[model samples]
Target: MTGWDISPAGVQSVVSNVRDAADAMNSGITLYGKSVEGAMTSAGTLSFGTDGVGGDAAGLVALALAKFVEGTERDMAFLPLRASNSANGAVEATNAYISGSLEQAWNAQRQATRAPDVTAFLEAARKKAGEGR
Candidate 1:
């Protein structure tokens, strides 16, 4: 009888770390932008709001990240208990697959959340600067 010992806490921790980082980044940018007296013009606002760099796009990305995390957490909620109680090899394989998939999803999400398109940032900044309003 093979035993699976996956920790749901461990999985949650991994996802939590990335989520925290994304939250921090988003908050920091928001804080910095707000701190400026007249840093953002309408063009920049529109760029971020409409273009695929920030604003609504970022919000949607955040929403997607949240849903992914919630779904993963729900899926793994019973995994720790199962790991401790189950003696079935099938459970072990299933746990492994779920954990592996969560890890992959985290990797993709982290990359997407952390890295913004430089071209978009530059264009937004340029437009904001040129608009002068």
Candidate 2:
């Protein structure tokens, strides 16, 4: 089922990415020969809002990232690796294809959204599950 079960880090990453991209796009106004004043007048301060360049870019970027998360999540979510790949001696290629997709998602999210501190959290969680200290 669908849900809004996103971590705070995820939300932050997404917002931060969108903000940064908006800044980059706004900066590009100079390349097209648009003066700061002209660009502002044309593009306006919408990039920082929810209905401007920032918003549109964020939506597009997020949708693509979600697909990445799904691909990796689903692939890893399954049991064993055989079911996910062919026996053409391409295990590495298969794993990479899956992981690379995740990497791309991660990159995009960093650009358009936030990501969780999964490594730290998981490491700590594993430690907790180990023999009592």
Q: Which one is best on lDDT? A: 1
Each model's TM-score, in the order given? 0.28, 0.24
Candidate 1 runs further than 4 Å off:
1-9, 38-96, 99-116, 120-133
Error of 1 at 132 (Å): 18
Writing each residue's lDDT as its tens digit, candidate 1 over 1-133 gives 1243556566555555645655565565457445432332221322353456565333444445556644554333333323322222223334554666645544443443343344555567679989996
Q: For model 2, what is the C-alpha lDDT against the true structure?
A: 0.40
- Per residue, candidate 2 scores C-alpha lDDT tens digits across 1-133 of 1221334454445545555654554455334324433443444222355655455233444445556554554233221222222121123323333454544433443332233344555467569879575
Overall lDDT per candidate, in order of appearance: 0.45, 0.40
Cα error, candidate 1, residue 37 (Å): 2.3
